[model samples]
Target: MLPCPLPVFKGKNCRFDSCPSHESPPSSLLPSLLSELGVWTALLFSVESRLQKGQLLSLVPSQLAAFCCFSENQELKIMSGKPILHYFNGRGRMESVRWLLAAAGVEFEEKILKSAEDFENLVKGGNLMYQQVPMVEIDGLNLVQTRAILKYIAAKYNLYGKDLKEKALIDMYVEGMRDLNEMIMHYPLCYPGEEEKNLNFILERATERFFPVYEKALKSHGKNYLVGNQMSWADIQLFEAILMVEELKSDILSAFPKLQEFKARMSKLPSIQKFLKPGSQRKEMDPMGLEEVKKIFKVDEDLFLKHMS
Candidate 1:
């Protein structure tokens, strides 16, 4: 039998372990060889039997190259499979994306940009289509634009609704939720002196305008979800907006019974429950997070106020 040519590891300290040139093939290489041959069960047994009785299992140069390529491709597949979110470490535009993915039970990783250089690096890498943060790398595509990313994720995860009309409704409801979320997301960035004023504006709009829309939808639909009977992108966005508003005004839902009931029902979902846990991917907008955002984006209260106006 020809000896195995594959590199063998011995003791921890052995750096140059080698097998005899005439010894039987090692059992370690059997699985890879069997897998490459495309006959796992029967061929694995055959190879195992041969190895047990000291048989020859010679692999040619082409076979070795193919196996190496297969291993490399598998490694690449694993490394690129999980979605990577690139953004500042806070609840900005990326927060809705996070909420949608969590609701869909998809696991993802975050590349938190802590400095201007980090953002620049993303732009340099040509990953950000519009040279912006809140870019998500998923399914071998680097998705940018908050709405585009949200729509892609929603459609991919079967949360966009079942048909065109349902999708249109989901889109309409989501657009309203987006407006409400934008207000709450920027609330922390306002000047300290204007904080109360800005918060009051957000609360008034949320309670009087946004919350009532969702409240009536839930009430009229008489369904657990907003658009359709099942959970959709609109439902996810509504839940996220509700929580963000509640952060500013805990009693905001008291007057909206249907929305209050919707909140309770959505909260009990396993995925939503997981996201609401203390250590999940869900991020909170706070003083520290706000500072991080300002530092990373090089924005000040004036810039935020001007942009809002």
Candidate 2:
């Protein structure tokens, strides 16, 4: 009834310090407050009623001009029809999707949540179809699941394949890369006293099991991609996974010459290069050191080593 008593507005150069809601509870508080079904529904009703009658112009705190401009621009953006990608502020399961979007040169909106509370707010609001992230809103459909989202975007851009056989091949490669990713996750890179054991397992078991498959695929595919001798969603998935492995072990790709070449090839692509550059959209890898883990977890080195051994 009182116009929600907050700005609830965002613009390119929004100045929050001078706004009445500047002292509003921590960012999470408002979302939590508005999340109540009754409260949010009422607020939305009021907002919608005002919007329909064009009486919303007089409801602002003297920032009417800015509000009007922001509203018009947002309408134009919505009318122009860009897809919206919703995910946490990490590359975990979204990098391949980002790659596909970037490579396809499609302009999409990113809703990158910065905190766990923000994600919970979305869940509480039922915005996510599966109550999980890495969801995307595109083509009038809200899609969930990383692989499904990636395949959908790729298919739209012709990166999935040109024929049934190629699609099957891409699926095979994508599944293999997923398995490889699972293996890479097994290494406790941050566990104290287990660094040696973890690194050894990574170098010995994981490398032995996964690297050769990728190497063979790259070799047979002419060193550019994993299937059809052209870029596909699988290639982007594998390349992004390789970047994660490199963050854990700098030399993970050293022994696999072909994989090394593949990394170089993928890195040189214009879309991927832009994605890798320093930016908020690019996922940050702040790997925890063994020493830090030792301190924080209070791990007894002797016991740890004995158990690991």
Candidate 3:
């Protein structure tokens, strides 16, 4: 009733006409105090109430601490919301991340690196980890390395599986899918006269190697998903890998009935349904042979070819 010791708030009929300004708590002390106080909601409400009244209260130590805590908490809330994907506009390593998030029914935002400077800026910000794209900002951390990001998201969303055995199976299946996906991801970067050759190689590998693995898994399991009774990371990766192959050859699944059925069944999932529709985060293969990608990343044909090799 003594008009509240903190002078920033003028709640209801209370006024702080004579309250002395207290020195702000030391920066190191703020965190401990905030944790000990455990009154974030009350402090925030008081600040909001003051703001609503258009009263510009002079900053006192308590008010400064409250403001700082509120700002940091707000930032964490935002980072914990939608994930922010950083990559070139074209689909590359980040595409799998997109697919997994989509299938998990998690919406995300993208910071497409349209120029070298845009990428440099991220590196300068010190959040790019190994200075790589496909870096994701989520849950108050800048996550790098594609597999790590995927594993975290999958585990967070309950798609990793129920136990160690299931997770191991999912990992096995996903590794194979990653192998196939890497092939498809680099196919477009093939040398000028080697598109046909690369295309044939991808088809050969998919039919002779990758497709059969998943086909056999689905058939052997006799379930709707690849690794378990429920959908897991493997299922989403397989679904995405199937689509990537289909883009190259529409009838690629003709030989694998199980894969065909798996494709159909996966397409019916609500999350996958949303992703399949036009204008979703799902990206089309670069129409200009990823010319934009080359320009943005500043990679010449020789470099791409070398990387592919």
TM-score for each model: 0.73, 0.62, 0.76
Ranked by lDDT from best down, the candidates are 3, 1, 2
lDDT at 42, model 3:
23
Off by over 4 Å in 1: 1-80, 304-309
Best by TM-score: 3
By TM-score, is 2 or 3 better? 3
Instruction: State the lDDT of candidate 2 residue by residue for 124-171, as single tens digits.
Output: 777566666677877657788777788888987779878999899889
How many residue pairs in model 1 have overlapping backbones? 0
The 0-to-1 C-alpha lDDT of every candidate, in the order given, reads: 0.71, 0.60, 0.73
Q: Write the per-residue lDDT of candidate 3 for residues 1-309, one digit (tens) a residue.
A: 122234442223322245533333344544555465453322332422222322222232221222222221221111125788988776788889999999999889998887768877888999876766778877657898889999999998999999999999999999988988988987876778999999999999999998998888888868988877999999999999999999999999999999999999999999999999999988888858477666756778667532111
What residue runs in model 2 are displaced by over 4 Å at the alpha carbon? Answer: 1-80, 115-117, 185-195, 221-223, 287-309
Q: Which candidate do you rate higher for lDDT, 2 or 3?
A: 3
> What would the per-residue lDDT of candidate 1 be over residues 81-162, giving only the tens digit for each residue?
4678987777778889999999998888999888877877778898777676678887558888889999999998899989
